[model samples]
Target chain A: MSSTLIALAAVCAANPFRVAACAPTSTDIRRQAVAVATALSVAAVGLLAVLSEAILDWLNVSGSSSRIAAGAAVLVVGTRDLFIQPPSPEPALQGWRAGIVPMGFPVILTPALAILAISAGSERGAGTAVGMIGAAILVVAVIAVGNIRGTYWRTATVGSAGVVFGTLLLLNGVTAI
Target chain B: MSPVSTRVVRGVLAWILVLGVVALVVHPEGCGQPSSGEVNEAAVATVAWFGANINDDGTFVYRYDRAENRPLGGYNDVRHAGVLLSLYQAESAGIEGAAEIADRGLAYVDERLLNTPIGLVFGRGASARSGSVGLLVAALDERRWATGADDRDPLLLALGRTLTGVVNADGSVGASINTATGSTSGRSPFFTGEVLWALARLHLTFPDENFDEPALRVYRYLIEDRDRVESPWPPVSDHWGAYALETMSRWPNADDLQLEPDLELDGPATRQWLARQLGLFGLQVRYESQRQGGITRLTRGTVALPAGVGTLGEGIGNYLRFLDRFEVTDIDVDALNERTNCVAHLLTNRQVSAAQAQQYAEPLRVQGAWFRNDITQMDDQQHALSALLLLEDWMPQ
Candidate 1:
């Protein structure tokens, strides 16, 4: 959605959205979306490097098979983004409800991201996971403040595009391997 | 000011004024002159006598006379070789009389007893060689004091080196070889104890870099070696044990000394043992009866029992001297008093001829009768002058 893209763009411009991705706050829906996306990126990078083998084992897949699957998923997302036109403009929401689903769930809590969260929870125990989640929420609340300005969205648009291109290269590399 | 505060301030001011007046009236130079000079002179004389009696080969003869010697020999015969070494060294140092005595004694030892253990036992199986090393070390220090001589005797150095070699790494010195056949069977605690004492004395006096290790090893063995079980005469050999313990305890580095657990004895136990051997003197008064009633008097031309009481007196005197030297306050004076009382009782009760009593008791007196009566006279006296050296530091100003 246009609204979602604008929120992501705003996050890229205001570094606060990077932190907010792991935490959520009562903020504009687009701001929350940007924060969630940032959290997903962080979790994905962490899982691939630090806990790749454990993640694969937990998913009941070999390391090589998991890498292949991740590459295919990334390729599918990149292709869809590059070729497809969105059908509807995203609806803007003003409060906490908007942050709960799109921003707090899918953007930050994607399937790969969920795997990482589960692995982190298992590694550090449930108490540490709760503490980490609390910290993430605090960070996202602070980041959401920047969403009030339109200039932030313009700058964030370029950054999000860069991230998508990088993610595409990463997927190609994984597929080649 | 309030009346009370004013009174307190005035009182303090008056006290200070009185102290100032007293200090001005008492001259330190006048008070110190006689005792200090006398002590120094006595020290010099004692060192001189030791030097004069030394033989050429590093041993000392009893006296100039050979015919007057008893079978066990004279007091000098028993102790001179060991005592003279310090005297000779003192004389060499420019202590007026000490140099002559040291030279004479050194010459005598060189000529008569070089390379033989005869010097080790000058009287009554008293070890001359082992005792000589200690005496020599003491003499060297005296000679340094007497003649201002800085050059140490190489023979004395060799003697220490040889002793270090004889002592095992574990601290035991091997038994002396039988003169007839150069074979040793078991160790003699007396000889070993004396040797360790000498080594410790040498460390105290000359204090070379090499002496520390061997001295500590020997000290540990003598004071703490339990399972190496070597002493044959337990009762009679106690003086040596006390001597070693006392000497080791006086060493500057004693705190760093570690002994085997089995060998480590508490201070009380060691003190008790020394008390029994030295008589009930000062703090060690538990065994007063043993020395209390024996042969209280001696007469002219009296061939009486050799009341072994003198040994205890001498031992107590030595212990006191050690305590005084080290400034040790943790001693039982009751023990010392009991021993002193016994000796005093013996002396007072005996109706012996003055000359006979003096002759018999002189050697038994801790630092000779002169110092025994008046410590002020201990300066140049030649008996157990070491005791005086220790006491001088503690003397009331």
Candidate 2:
């Protein structure tokens, strides 16, 4: 179960949220989708590697303390995923601009993901985190290109990932004790 | 197995694995409990730090910044006497060279000890404070007890007598005095505890019936009257009073020490006072232990100063000793153990090795000294060394 959760969370974390946000209408904009996701993933992981420590220091929060807070947030998100039903699809985003719209901002680079990036980077160090994020993005790009999941399976996979991430977060926080 | 059952089992197993890994990593075997040998090593190292750091004149080095390798100047008489007292404790604990180190300190004190109309006192003129005199007297009393040499040092005995002279009829010791002129420095908050502790030891060592009336007077004022609460001195938790209570509890005639039937000496009342001090100055630490695996926070408090924390340890230790001798059952031993362990761990962690100190100026390279936040001071080493040495007994066997 732990192994399965780790795999699923990786996939879910790497999933190009733009693909879901753009949906049926923006499927033809494949080049833009791949380009934007790859670029954003690189930039996000890079920023996390470089700035998280300084930011946390500026906030007067120890790395260990922030790790605890991050774990709690991840736990809440994971618990939510386990219980909540996915909402029905929103209206399909129209035109090439959809790559940058709700998909790029909220779906792809969420607050949780941003937090996860910083904490993971802190725990794993910059080089490992960058590789992990890059690999996650590559896997996400392949999945987005394949566009091969039914809604139920996608939801289940994402939810399973949440469980794994939340458990990991909880574990990280507990170790800090 | 059914699919759900299999999945649940796997999940539980994974969680257990993570938890186990965390526990193993964060708290390896023998993490909290230092071996008796390690305590000795650390104690020896601390004594070595003291030995390496004292000036030729016998005054301990006041402060040194390890990173910059610089000496920071400042000194306090009470802390100097406190360090002297701790050295005697170290010698009794069988730390090598502690007696020599203490002798050097005594020599320094000898220079400061002056003949006054009242009695033998430390420091010059207006600067000679009762607390310093009390600590020096107490150190002398401890040394006398350990050696069991009946021929007393006249200066030490005189200091004891002089300390008794300062205890007012109501039990408060005057804060400071012009040893030359007998001028008063007025009453201070902490003097009662210092004076009480010294007088209690004075009585303990000499068995002087004359010392009892004044000792009891101070005890009544400190315990029954709660004089600090009424006086301008803030009602701060007094570790000195706690020490005195512990001393009075073990005196040969323990029952006779208590003047009033209802006056609490070293029981719940003493615990309450010590607990308050442990609460105020104690630090609550939350740190990551990789072995625990999950996001966890442990809020455990331990007293954290060199002087106050060390004094508190002795105070609480005496309380614990009192409880065990009387076979008192109501007190919480677990809480005492936790506090003991926390302080022990803290003292160990804060210790600055001689090798570590060698990075500083030639004079500052006194290994085995303890410091906090890169700043080392004489009192810091004195208190922590005393606390750690006392911990040999307070910690579980």
Candidate 3:
């Protein structure tokens, strides 16, 4: 099982992109966006798995080396999360749809997530479990950010989880090398 | 010039001077070079030591702590067969006492030989492993070629035949076998390679038509389904694969072997591929050297383990064989040779001295063995000895 995949999944689940895109929406609109975003996230995981070998061959890199690089990227994201404060929510942009453009196209289905998905796909059981967990986290984060009793505690929890994921990827990368 | 500009120039000059001094100190002339006769002398000493150190029942004393100078572990057939292969190679090269040492190693393997309905196998009960049998077959072939003896001809051929079962119809080889049930246990890239080499050698040594198809099957499996079978994917410079390819390329009427187009490296292609893989190891050492102080010593107070170094040596040595045998021209053989020389020098430096010999109660002393602080394993000597033997053949005397 790849720690890198789980770490990347954690990163994707806690990403600012989704929060930034959906933060301005109404309660009903946000719920619809989360559902659409979750579907995109799961689809991206499957697509990455199918195309991983071809992508690696095109890049002329081995799976192990790619995992190491992905692990490094995850570490960078985690470190950034640890030090920086979260951005304040903005009013919804004119002509912006909730799911298809920002949330589905780029926020949930990112290039970094694509790389992690492919690498993780090699480990079948682990990848499935993590991908499901990642989708669940996205849904929960969307619903809980405003409605939850302690939003500060939610932010702290996300930050702590990010640190743990980063550390695991970093250690696994070192061991693989 | 202004005072600031003058100071900047002085600072630039100072930095260059410091960098130059560091470079010179880090890589001195002949720093990792072994003496001309050093490797051969060590090889001979190693061959002699193994002969003297084997127990009467034929298994070797497995591990040694050079600092304590004492034997430290239980014996096993896999390492025992590896020692046999080294001894056979040394003897084939006319190294004195190598034949006698090889004979002792052969005795150890012979004791473990099993006669199955399919063919001759090595090891007993659940401990019987196909990889061990493959190594024995290789050793016997070398012994026969060196001495021109055919007394064990039938047994040798049969042992080679037994390996057919080790490989599945799909070409994946079970590394170990339960001789009692004739069932395979575990699959690995390493075992697949060892059996491939043995099968190829069996055909080359005897020119039997029967061995060809089996050899081809293993080769196909290795090249095609490597990712599926390789435990750790992106298989690194697998030396056994290098050896197997070299053997197949050099076989009589090699073009007639009817290899798959994708698998067909011909002579030059196989040679270049092996050399390229070996070159990566040199690159690894260079990367390590820039980050760590030297190749011989690992950082954090740990010395380089000879087994690891020797494994690299063996890979380099085999790569050299391809260069020599195929008369390969495209690759930079000299640079690769230097990489091997660096490893040899490290192994030679790490060998225990005569003055240090008395500390160990063992009669053989710690001679011809490489150590990491205190401990050395048998494969360390077997591989290091083989690498030195290759170096002797490689260098112009």
Winner by lDDT between candidate 3 and candidate 2: 3
Q: Who is ahead in DockQ, 1 or 3?
A: 3
- 1 or 2: which has the higher lDDT? 2
lDDT of 1 by residue, B271-299 (tens): 44543444223212112222222231111
In order, the Cα lDDT scores of the candidates are 0.40, 0.60, 0.61
lDDT of 2 by residue, B1-397 (tens): 7543443354356345433433322231112555556666777887887887778888887887776777888888888888888888888888868877877887788778777777778876555899999888878877776655444467677888888778877776788877667655577677888888888887777785467678888887876565445554334546677667768877888855455554555445444544444333221222211112233323222223455546545655555566665544544354356555655655565566555655666534556765555667888777667767767775555
Off by over 4 Å in 1: A1-177, B1-78, B85-99, B112-138, B141-148, B175-186, B205-208, B225-234, B237-247, B260-314, B321-331, B337-397
Candidate 3's DockQ: 0.01
The 10-residue segment of model 3 chain B with minimum total lDDT is B22-31
Tens digits of per-residue lDDT for model 3 on A1-177? 344346444554346433543443466665565566566667666777667767655653434344544454444444444554543332222232435344544334444455456656543433574464465446545553354332344444555565566556534433331
Worst 10 residues of 2 chain B by lDDT: B283-292
**Residue B234, candidate 3: alpha-carbon lDDT:** 50
Interface Cα RMSD, each model: 46.6, 13.6, 16.1
Clashes of each: 83, 20, 0
lDDT of residue A25 for candidate 1: 39
Arrange candidates, best lDDT first: 3, 2, 1
Over all chains combined, what TM-score does candidate 2 have? 0.59
Lowest lDDT block of 10, candidate 1 chain A:
A84-93
